[model samples]
Target: MDRARLAGFLRARREALQPEDVGLPRGPRRRTGGLRREEVAALSGMSADYYSRIEQQRGPHPSEQMLAALARGLRLSLAERDHLFQLGGFPVPRHAVRADHVNPGMMRILDRLQDTPAQVVNHLGETLAQTAPAVALLGDETRHSGLARSAHYRWFTDPQARTPVPAEDHATRSRLMAAHLHAAYTRDGRGSRAAVIVDALLATSAEFAELWREHPVQSAYCPPKRLRHPEVGALELHCQVLVDPDQSQTLMVFTAAPGTESDEKLRLLAVIGAQRV
Candidate 1:
């Protein structure tokens, strides 16, 4: 890896971003205008010490995953993200088909929605990032790996995946999830990740297999959802989706009507703050 160049690039990018740029507050005691190493590390989902070592050019070679995390954390453009991978002695990511790398503009919007239940998901239903409130409401969808990374896969394979939604909604949710996967599979074609997930589910989930035969089509609209939170009881929320120009990623914001019980429950969720009671 080009240690010197990579360190320089990281430092420059970190310094260029202001607190407001990433939805962080500039406290009265703040000295420099740029974001601190800890702030960047927090946003990047890495330890401050680990990030510090990289800036000092004394750490081990960063892996591709690490570089991708840094790219997302810094809200780097596609060009800058590719440069970051190059400096780390890796190939430039094929972000066109690989939807893991969220757009910087979308990341900025997610950053601003810290208090709202907001998350960004790729076309294949892989969660790219989530706000704290989203975590509180949705239980950290980004934590899964492999086929389980796709909610469509998890919904049929893992029973607990559907815990948030009420029992009455399970069949409808299953159909929608299957239809969404079918859309992704059709778009990506065979040998794509979507197809891989489809193949896996076809082998394992009888429900998914049955749904696939019916050839369900996903609708353009995202309808209201009823969720049964363990701590907060029942909630009826509307999901607002903002699709990226590329149509590869979508930002989903969950909100309830004003002056309603669900809205009050959401307020209580803010206070609960991702902690399960």
Candidate 2:
């Protein structure tokens, strides 16, 4: 690894960011330029000492996962993220098929909605980024990877994933997910990420494979989703999706019907979620 170059790049990105850029406050006593190294470490999900070591060019080589976290924490663009990987002596991720990078437009929207439950998820059902409320509301969707990264895969392969959705909607959601995967698999063809997921689901999940055989092709995300939170109970929130065509990323914003019990619950959720975060 080009430790010196990597450290310099990380430092540059860190200094270039303001506290407000990453949903942090600039306190009255603060005198450091941009975000503190500790703040960056917190955002990157690493210890302050470890991150400081890397910045000081005295740490061990950073793994690809750590670099990925840093990229997200730094809010780097796709090109910049690739550059970070290259600088760390890691190959840039191939971008022809799968895309996890949240486009700038979506990031802007997410940045503005600190209280709302919003997330940028790719076509393959992998959540790329989520707001604090989203983490609280949906139990941190960004915590998984591999086949588990796709909620559809998790739905069939693991029973625990159905906690959010009611039992009644499971069949419909499964069909929708299966249809979505089929469409993506067909569009991308062989050896595609979607195809890999499809193959895995077909082999492991009989229900998913059954749903796939039915050839359901609904691509549009349904509105007014019924999601249950262990803390908030059942919530009837509308799911508004904004799609970025170039990146195949969908930004979903969740809001409840105003003046209703659900609205009151969502308001409570903001307070409850903040504490959880």
Candidate 3:
């Protein structure tokens, strides 16, 4: 760990905030500006002595979990949190690295492609936003919360999520999900959001456990996707993925070639969805 830089960053973040900002009372007798070291320790759920040692640059390497707590306590933005993790000599968790904000370029493209089935998803497979046609195709996957918010997490936990995934394709999807999550876990290591999902699955899913042992470790998998929509029946569409490196968000647009039955069904679904909206 870069103790000096980490300590400096921590101290700076603590000093930049007011007691009121973190929902604490500022007593009249308080002489120092910003929050005290003790307050930071309390907010971070660590002992004052341990926290002080870190600020003093004398402590052992802080784990990723400790850094995450510090990030939360300091109310660090996604970029700031990433800086903290870097200073701590740990890669920021991929899920933690995901920013919910869609960039203007992406937004503009989404606006122009209103009739297309498109959605933006973060690195963790959480849908940040979706076009109406995308919602109609995927059933508004952005509606989930907590661990279930991740499409990867829900594939094993929610049966409804697997409904669109054909029985023949279940193994492939499961392998893909496991492989992608494995890549995430490898990147972030322990105390990561991906680890949390893996832990939960290890405890609950026998299938996940088996696949985790023997799965393709590919991080990027893009194949022509098949969707079994109840209203539109079956659709074989090309799944195009656009990545924003700064935000780690993916724009997945579904398209079918012209003069195809899938193309007609896609447009019809868009019209139907727009009418419902």
Candidate 4:
């Protein structure tokens, strides 16, 4: 890796971001022109010292995962992210249909929705990032790996995937998940991640196999979602989706009607934070 050049690039990017740019408050006594190392590290999901060592050019070579996290944390564009990978002595990630990279504009919008139950999910139903309230509402959907990463895969195979939704909704939810996966598979043909998920589900999940035969397709509208939180009880919320066509990612924000019990429950969830419900 070109440690000097990498360090310089990282430093310049870090200095270019202000607290307000990333939805952080600027304290009255703050003197730094941009976000602190610790703030960047926190945003990147790494330790402050680990990030500092990179800027100092004294740490071990950063892995591709680390570079990707840095790119997201710094709100780098696709061009900037590819440059980061190159500087780290790695090949640029292939720009394809299954774009796991969350767009910087989307991240900025998500940062501003800290108190709202919101998350960024790719087309394959893999969650990329979530707000604290989202974790409280939907658990940490980003914690899964492999095929389990896709919600469509989990709905039919993992019982725990249906925990938040009521048992009565399971049948309808399953159909919806199937339809969503079918849409993704149609967009991304053979050998794509969507196809991989489909092939695996067809082999393993009898329910998914049965549904695949029906050829369900997702509707343009997203219906209201009903969720049961252990602490908050039943909450009927409306999900607002913002689509990023370029990245094939959707930003989902959940909210309840004003002056309703569900609205109060959502506010309570924000206070509960990310504590496992």
Candidate 5:
């Protein structure tokens, strides 16, 4: 969208980091804002001229290795690294939207993971398909609840959504989901439906808007989640997200580690979910 602003943001962030911030020694009488272009070039294994071109918006495509180096030199957070990649025209790593719809095999995979509270989500965290247990895990009563709705709408607008999960955990999950969605939108040329979803979420939730603007990117598959389920009380759940190599979908499964109270509680939830089904 704003290529110039993107480039400027990258340059500004690069210039904002001190030499010591990136493990470089502070030199004598430096007049520039942050680390010198030559210093960044040295850290990124590129010529100073080449790095200057990048900063000036005249450079050619940057390789993945170059981006990684720049990210390290800039001391970028996960979000910052992703924004750098997008600005450099590098392929953002994650799923992409396809012209074809979700495959039946993928749907079957979600069905089979019934016991494991699983759902099929697009790269944008939209729940394309989900199992009964997965819906229950998120405390959604309806059978057709979408991940986008669960995350953007209910999480922000509905008190019941926050009631089932601790405040801190809910915020973490929302940020993580937003980061993943941001990567998806960036990778898809910034004009896909996923990007629209991001814009809508940004418009609706100020928190989502702030995180999206930060441009965080994460491939967080299995993060721990704390749930205060209405029926089950407090429980900790581990989330596992599987990226479908052949398709632009992620299979997110929630499981409790073996021989723990969480595992027992998850089992109980599974039983209750089965009865409702």
Candidate 6:
């Protein structure tokens, strides 16, 4: 990753804020950019030395609370806040993941969901297991890809892939998912794999970078999604995500409730899958 560029970005962002931006008093004869290290530390409830180290990119990992404080003190935009967390080697604080691997029971659950689109996602949205329907939903025959590498990245970065969702919702979803991944990274101790994904996404999509600044939070729950398939026109699907009570795995299922047009379409999709098989 571009440590120097990240440091420079952090410094530049900090310098651009006025004292009033974070409720600090403007000191007389201030010649430097943004708030001083002491001022930021005071606002963020951290020591000046510690804040200095962060600015210098020499500090140890920061806690989620501390990062939140700094984000507020710096008046960082959402994207900027995400960037700060990335630089600090801390996962973005949102929906935290537990450090355990998937279990046999959860895998069995995925297998049982044969007709429904179901998959297992970690806190970072990595696909650990998937049913046949889930793989078909992603237009992939094999369930080997990570959710982080799937349409989440493409929806924001690729205009062609983004044609399905409304622009505003698309952007919101992107930010929310990134925030969820960030939270997972934080919970899992900010591993290199997470960092690499974040960096690659940022490099490829300015929209992702902009949304990342927003610092959104995502929980594993059911939500409705609007999708426009190339041949199917428009579809609204309800997404249900169940977190294993005993493990860190999240079981996600998508279904179209009975007696709806979406249900009919889903049935059609299933038939298509059967034909392909």
- Give the clashing residue pairs of candidate 5, or none: 79-216
Q: Tens digit of lDDT per residue, candidate 5, span 1-277?
A: 3347656876788778776555455777877768777887875557999888776777576677677667655556555766777876765644232312344456545545656788776555556555667767774433334433435445554566578668767768777767766776777766676666666677778888888778887764566878787677788877776677656667778888899988887888878874443
Tell me the tens digit of each residue's lDDT in model 2 across 1-277: 8999999999999998988887788899888778899999988789999999999999789998889888877888888899999989999888753386667567767877888989999888889888888887887888897889987788889889887899999887788778878877877789888888898988998898788888888767574689888887898989889889888888998898789888898888878874643
Q: How many backbone clashes does candidate 3 have?
A: 0
lDDT string for model 1 (91-156, tens) is 887744458888999999998999999999999999999998999988888989898999999999
> Which regions of candidate 5 are displaced past 4 Å?
1-100, 139-159, 274-277
Q: Model 3, 1-277: lDDT tens per residue?
A: 8999989999999999887766577899889898899998986779999999999999778998788778756767767878898999988667554455455456545655667889888767888667779988888786688889888889988898899877888988898888878876887789988798889988888999999888558656598878798887898999899988776677899999898999999988988893443
* Between candidates 3 and 4, the lDDT winner: 4
Error of 1 at 56 (Å): 1.0
Model 6 gets an lDDT of 0.64
Give candidate 2 misplaced runs (Cα > 4 Å): 96-98, 274-277
TM-score of each: 0.97, 0.91, 0.63, 0.97, 0.55, 0.55
Candidate with the larger TM-score of 1 and 5:
1
Error (Å) of candidate 5 at residue 19 is 63
Clash totals for all models, in order?
0, 0, 0, 0, 1, 7
- Looking at model 4, the pairs that clash are none
Model 5 score (lDDT): 0.66
Q: Which 10-residue span in candidate 3 carries the lowest summed lDDT? A: 95-104
lDDT by candidate, in order shown:
0.92, 0.84, 0.81, 0.92, 0.66, 0.64
Off by over 4 Å in 6: 1-102, 141-152, 155-163, 245-247, 274-277
lDDT of 4 at 127: 96
